[model samples]
Target chain A: MKDIIIRGATIRRELFFFLLSFIIAFGMNLYAIITFKTLWAELLTQLPFLILVTLVIYLIILLARIVFLGINKLLRIKKNKSSV
Target chain B: MNSPYKSRRAFIKKTIIGSTVLMSYPWLEALANESAISMSAANKVRVGIIGTGSRGQGLLYNLLAIETSHNIEIAAICDNYEPNYQKAIELTHGKAKAFYDYRELLDIKDIDAIVIATPLHQHAHIAIDAMNADKQVFCEKSMARTLADTKRMANTHYETGKILQIGHQRLFDKKYLDAIDYVRSGKIGNVTQIRAYWHRNNDWRRPVPEGKPELERKINWRLYKEYSCGLMTELASHQIQVANWVKDAQAVSVIGVGGINYWKDGREVYDNVALIYSYADGTQFIYDSMTSNRFYGLEEQILGDKGTFELEQNKMYSENPPQPAGILQLVNNIEKNIFEKIPIGGATWIPETALEYKGEYITGDFDVNETGISLEVFVDSVRRGKPTPGLFEQGYHASVWTLLGQQAMETQQKIYLPEELKI
Candidate 1:
């Protein structure tokens, strides 16, 4: 079994961390590949769609955050303008 | 031609029974009836309802459809909205007494139970007061808007010992519960993350007959932050609560932003939002909502190392490893056993059977919200004096909703939790 690693670097502080991460990452990747038949499986490694979605969603979510901030600022300015 | 037990019993019981038996041969078969199905315990409860808005009338329709003997009665109905109240009146078939104020209906002696479906701001105040009145209460979701109110609700319910069921109905859905089981059973192999979203178009409007902008906002409390926690509480509460259920832990931190964009109309809350809610175990829940796009709709996709399940209300699709992976197929070249049991007798000739692959299957139930499984459970808990899932403490979860939006609006920075916001 592969040990848990972050960015291909094995965890040194705790051996169990390596084991846990390896199992989880492997299993999730395997499941993701099997379900969606995604590109992650072509490289002999499994991928997790859950993680993919999570990452993608969060990325869009950040964009949404910026968009909201812009709108909030605009509204504040518009309110001040009308009052003046 | 019928036997004496059937023929003589009918004669002895009643001459009308005899007429029925004689008529059952052909023409009068329609007169026969089946016995009602019932699930009753010793203790029974009669219920009253306050605030017959859209949510309340939904509860009313579900209550009327129950043919079981869980000893529940829609003894009273109350609503400030006249049309909604009228609809509830028709739905209950005038079986319950109608009222405008909840206290007046609570005064009725026979109404031993109350279900509050009022706006978010009034949940704690009404529910606590009802509990103090010694009535079992089933309050709708997002119990209150403030931490202090949530604490008071938790206190009152704990003290009164009244059967209180908060209306986070997803807790009662079969798909959600099974999804929890699938993840917890390690089928997904330590589910590290989840994504939940709901998308809609058309600025949440239901024609105001004659009202000021303030009145319209008051009527449609969901569009305003003063009465609602916006989409986080109104819509995302159901999904966010499930994140805890599936991940088996409370969210540790949350960071997000929102703004009113589409159909501004001077609403206080935002039209779109995206949040990354972190859990104590380092897993994260990504939740979002948008008003400009209804194409994506609602979905909750959970991924684990072992498997993945994508859910849309009653429809659920789960993906496990394929059968071919476990099979040798036409060519007997492959033999990979994920979990192979040792031969019992240690004899090859004795024939150890190869692991059978049943393949994968999808499971789904149609018309989930229409099925009323959650409402029936609420009523059963009330009547049997039993506890239900998602108690008033779950309302404290709404505190996170308030905390998330308010902090984001005020600080203009991502929000982090100093304490575990759990009841």
Candidate 2:
């Protein structure tokens, strides 16, 4: 039950990151379209590009999360050693 | 997305697509064709500049900018004012023959066309004289100071059969053309009302040469009644022309009010004006101009049942904008979590304010130099030995209606366009 709960929390976190990445990517695409003064319908055709940008953002966010966790773990270990 | 459609590639694709779309327009296509035509030295159109004032110098700059591209030459320049004549001569690099009298400039047989940028009162006589001299004429807007003079200018054009193109540069503006096309396509439905205004905060005065107060009236001709109709002819004429173009009809009647409310600088013309022009189809064009507030600098808001076009900003807002479709809609649904449903039962609720729809641009490129393009088109017409169709009529109607609006203000009554003024 503990393992299941952990897995569920991990999935929710990943979903949140992905959603954030998608929003940023979509906003960037919309900005580009409006700036170019082209038809807004072109956003539909730019789906593949939008997805690529979203995935890149998601990867970056995941990498950042890993680095942050490593730093937090190191600090916690240093505290444990000092306490000992 | 990874291999071929990266950001750089996307930019390139958009640029290509945008240019292709622009090229499909008739004016751009014509401009391309015009640029392709090369002329020999002997075939160049020899042109003259009349009234080398501020406006004349502006036209001269545009003319010189396109001299090589359009196969045109500034053969001569004429200005009675000593300072303007000297400045014009300097601008031409002393290549153009300088003349004190415009009649001497007109006498030159080599000059094929002349651009008249004189004061409002001088437009009709100079343009009429240029036409009689067998020279193609390009005169500035507010064709003349009075309705009779405006009619006379049009009559002279009809009588001479010479190419006469007025300086209504918006007729050649790409953004305006595209917006008009959209309006005609019924994208905005029928334009029922147009609210246009030009507001500025300045004295509208030109500095006299130190200790030369006598030159004040001559230098600042726009502020005097004899020389100009002030804000109406100088500023409102341009917006009125746009309103007329959007409606495709001239103002049938106008009622106006004006006063020299703010400046109190002893200028004969009004410093502020507000007018309502009624079109034949009952379309109302409300126009106002002032020199006291600079907030809403200038705009012609063409409103219709379906949408509104803020022309100066080159933006269009729709009453009923389309919902996001395909990928956008999918993303929006996922973000909003489509599975969630909220119950709503309330008293009557309605939006009682303007919709916050961010409008879209009317055209891809908005950096068009309309004045330069207008001059280039005039040169092209001169080369072809024919006038641009509908240009003269547009200028004529705009000038006539604008003066009538001024008349309405002075008479304190609704003024109608006289039948004789209709060409």
Per-residue lDDT of candidate 2, residues B1-423 (tens digit):
132212222332243344554345343444545534466887799999999999999999988877876678999999999999999999999999999989999999989999999889999988999999999999998889999899888888998889888889887676787777778778899889999999999999989999999999999999999999999999999999999989878888999999998899889999999999998999999999999999999999999999999988989998887644444544555557866665486645664888767888887776667788778778877887877667788888889888999999999999987778777
Instruction: Please report the candidate that would top DockQ against the real structure.
Output: 2
**Cα-based RMSD of candidate 2:** 9.7
lDDT of 1 by residue, B1-423 (tens): 232223222222232233432223221121122122243544445778898888887777666655233446787888877887788788878878998887888788767788888888888888888888878887887767765676778778778888666777665444564555556556667677799899998788666767454558658888777788777677887777777667655676777877777877877877888888887778878888988899999988786666566655433333454534211121123123434566677665855673343423223432245225545555555654645444444445645554564465556676665454445
Q: Look at candidate 1 and give me any clashing residue pairs.
A: A4-A18, A27-B305, A28-B305, A29-A46, A29-A47, B188-B306
CA shift of B389, model 1, Å: 6.5
TM-score of 1: 0.64
TM-score of each: 0.64, 0.76
Off by over 4 Å in 2: A1-84, B1-38, B324-351
Name the fnat for model 1: 0.00
Best by lDDT: 2
